[model samples]
Target: MIDAGALTRCRHRVHLDAAFPEQLAAAPEDPGVRQRQDAATAKREGIRRTLTEHAPDRWVQIDREQSARRRAEDTLAACAAGADRIWGAVLPLDRDVGRKAHCEILIRDTDRGGYIPVIVVNHKVTDPGRGAVTSGMFEWEPREDLARKPRGQARDQMRVAQVYRMLEQHGFASPALVAGAIGYGSDVIFVHDLTAILEDYDERFVDRLAIARGESATVPSKIGECRSCPWWPGCEEQLTQTHDVSLVASGSRADLLREAGCRTIDDLAAWDQEPIEDWPHGAFEDAVVTAKAWLAGAPLVRRYSQIRVTRADIEVDVDMESYQEHGAYLWGTLLNADGISVYRPFVSWDPLPTPDEARSFAEFWTWLMAEREAAALSGKTFAAYCYSRAAEDKWLLDSARRFVGTPGIPTEDEIREFIDSPQWVDIYQAVSDQFICPAGKGLKKIAPVAGFRWRDADASGEASMSWYREAVGYDGEPDLSQRERLLQYNEDDVIATKVLREWMSDRAESEIPLATDL
Candidate 1:
């Protein structure tokens, strides 16, 4: 059946899920997906309990342990009885469209005399603005009384829309055409105008339904979603064998290039015509260069005649470890000065979403600033490096803002000034400007070229995410061994940046071929 995810999932995946269910079942689910699903399930249950406790007499909860058919019967009965709240409600499937919805909650809309679907999701649904918010425990309506940022959780809105469709089929949809979502760990509900969402939602739903039903042909294209897709291996193999343009170009850009007659890597590399009007300036050229690099079997191509990286007498490589979106829990640093290198980690062992994180971050900032001050006192140039500026900069600013009055925590302006200064260098940006990484620009992908290897064979950001759960005792007793492993992994990451910087400085020009020459 077409679920909410089908609305947002890769088109190819939707086809595979429906037409080749057996293959999908054979393929192992991504560990991260499994973990997230489990967490979301727990969070949903917690929300149900919270709502029930607040208004036990008004809430009607269907037993999820029952079959889907039976759950739908009970849910409908509750709605017909004018129940104020219904949890774990499976709406009657829309056979015409083959759509179904397992709503987290259906709150009775007194004005509309029908139920409004509310989805409980495991991630933050709101950013930090005035949003249409309501209390989850009470009957909800769109209101701006609560402080909430309306982060457009498209999936959540689509999920509600899916349920709305099913509700319409059952003749129990709210006339107001609105829905709500409660983010995990939050007590407030963010409402959505179904009218505003249904236009785009309906268009995509029909398209997805056709693909799922085999009425439309589905072609695989590499996308950001492929990282977590079960069909990625087969799709990747097919794309590789066919020398698809997506191998060099990204997302829909590959499709656009294909439509523009550059259907494959060779075609793109050989194109000598005027730049495609659809492409941004220089992007098409970059794609052509990348295609050439790929054909030459060069993972990276130097963009210039000579490459240079910022170097200092006192160099610090920094890498921060965050536990999902909860908070940054670990700040790993590699300090090199006066012919000596030291690895230091400021870690908070406490479970994340805790105040202790502020303490750890504050300490790390204080220490780093002190080191920079010491370098100035010694009249030595100092520079701080991080592989990618995005993550580090995010936490630096976020931590400062989150823990405003906390001792030793730098102000957001101070953090911004540091990142904006020449003293703070993003090695990833340096790599991007100096080289074209056809494969990828991730540290794991490029560090090997520079002779830098992680001590742990399984070292990866994805692997670290799982290890973090164990280290922090998310399920049970904390695994101290995993904690040590994370520290080692973090240290290795910082060291890799240092190694990459040194390699770019001393060996890159002599070792790597330039793009123009290629």
Candidate 2:
């Protein structure tokens, strides 16, 4: 029996193909995966408890429904108490087969004489109001910033429609969707009508389910979704054996190549010698280069033969560690010169904006500006490098704006000019432009390939956040060891960026590409 959750994941063909098999198989335990799952479960239960407390006298818990008939009867009885809340109400899709949906919350409308199903979500709502308007059911999600506008796609309406179908099948009154988002110490609810979306889903998703059921062949797609998938290892091995073109190309490029009769990397690599008939004229050369890079296991494939290097005598690699709730807490910098390396860390012990945090931010900016000025005075070029510039750039801009009157805070104009200047480099963009990453594009994934390793085996952004929480005395007394470990992790990140920069410099100078290069 396909539940609403299972049907939702059916949007991806690869996920759909692996779902049933994975359910029946005994999969190996992944700590990261388990941690995430546990966190989600706890969040859901916490929200459920909160909602239950809000309408304690009115709520009727109906999670114990044994069959579809029993669920329908229980749900109907619960709805009799108009304007009251029903928690864990089971709604039936088919009585004979006993297919049911255990809704998170249901609100009975006295005036409207119907039930409004509320789907509880622990994660941030990517879309808030649109899903209900499109699919006719409400979505509940966390809201970090209430001022930010809700965004969503029309395709997301299908999930709401599925829930609406169950309500209709169970002979329950369907009304507007109510989305409850709990975050930032409050619950934000959004309401919308899903009539049109439900009709569209009936016309579209019903037939797709039939096709999905009959699908015997696995549809392999190399995408971000594959990272946490249980079937990834087996699927990757199969794709590698077949030299699947998806290993080197994805989305429309993969489709175009496959349509042009270049189904695999082997085919694409040989295409340049004898170009395929009706092949895309523009992408032909690039496709061949990418294919060759994949075949040769090259680190990078340069589109242009000539490499552009920014000459600098003084180089600094920067990495920032921050919690979403808190502002940037740690600014790690790795300074490099001829036969000299130094690690500098500017840190804030406070979780939120206090005098200490303000001082830390001020110190970091002052030190950075001083170093840049010193380089200029000495007639040497100074450049600051980071793995991905978005977070670092955003934090700098935000801190400048938030602490405008604070001493040592650079002006917004100065910050913008500095970021836009050639003195600042984003190594991720540089590497991506020059190389085709077959393994993955993350710093942790790519850095190890260049012989850069962290002292801590399990160092990650999530792990650092967890350690920071402990260091800040979230659970108990602040552990100095945890704080030290976090600093070390941040130091390793900056060093990794430095290593990547040096590796790029050497490759550009020698013009000798790595084995993965095209």
Per-structure clash totals for the candidates: 0, 9
TM-scores for every predicted model: 0.95, 0.77
- The parts of candidate 1 lying over 4 Å away from their true place are 129-139, 144-149, 184-187, 278-282
Clashing pairs in 2: 136-194, 141-181, 297-516, 298-515, 298-516, 298-517, 299-516, 299-517, 300-435
Clashes of 1: 0
How far does residue 243 in candidate 2 sit from its true spot (Å)?
1.3
Looking at candidate 1, the ten consecutive residues that score lowest on lDDT are 128-137
lDDT of 2 by residue, 6-52 (tens): 44442355345535666536666655555455555655677677767
Model 1 agreement with the true structure over 1-518: per-residue lDDT tens digits: 68888899999999999998888888986878877886787688778777789879988889989999999999999988999888889977777778888998888888768888888888987776565565544657466745666787778888999899888877899898888888855667877878899999999999999999999998998988988898989999999998899878868788788788778889988989997776842466788899999899987898898898899999999999997778899999999988788999999999888999999998999999999999999899999999888989989999999899988889999998899999999999899888888988999999999999899998878778888888989889999999999999999999999999999999999888987888
* lDDT per model vs. reference: 0.87, 0.67
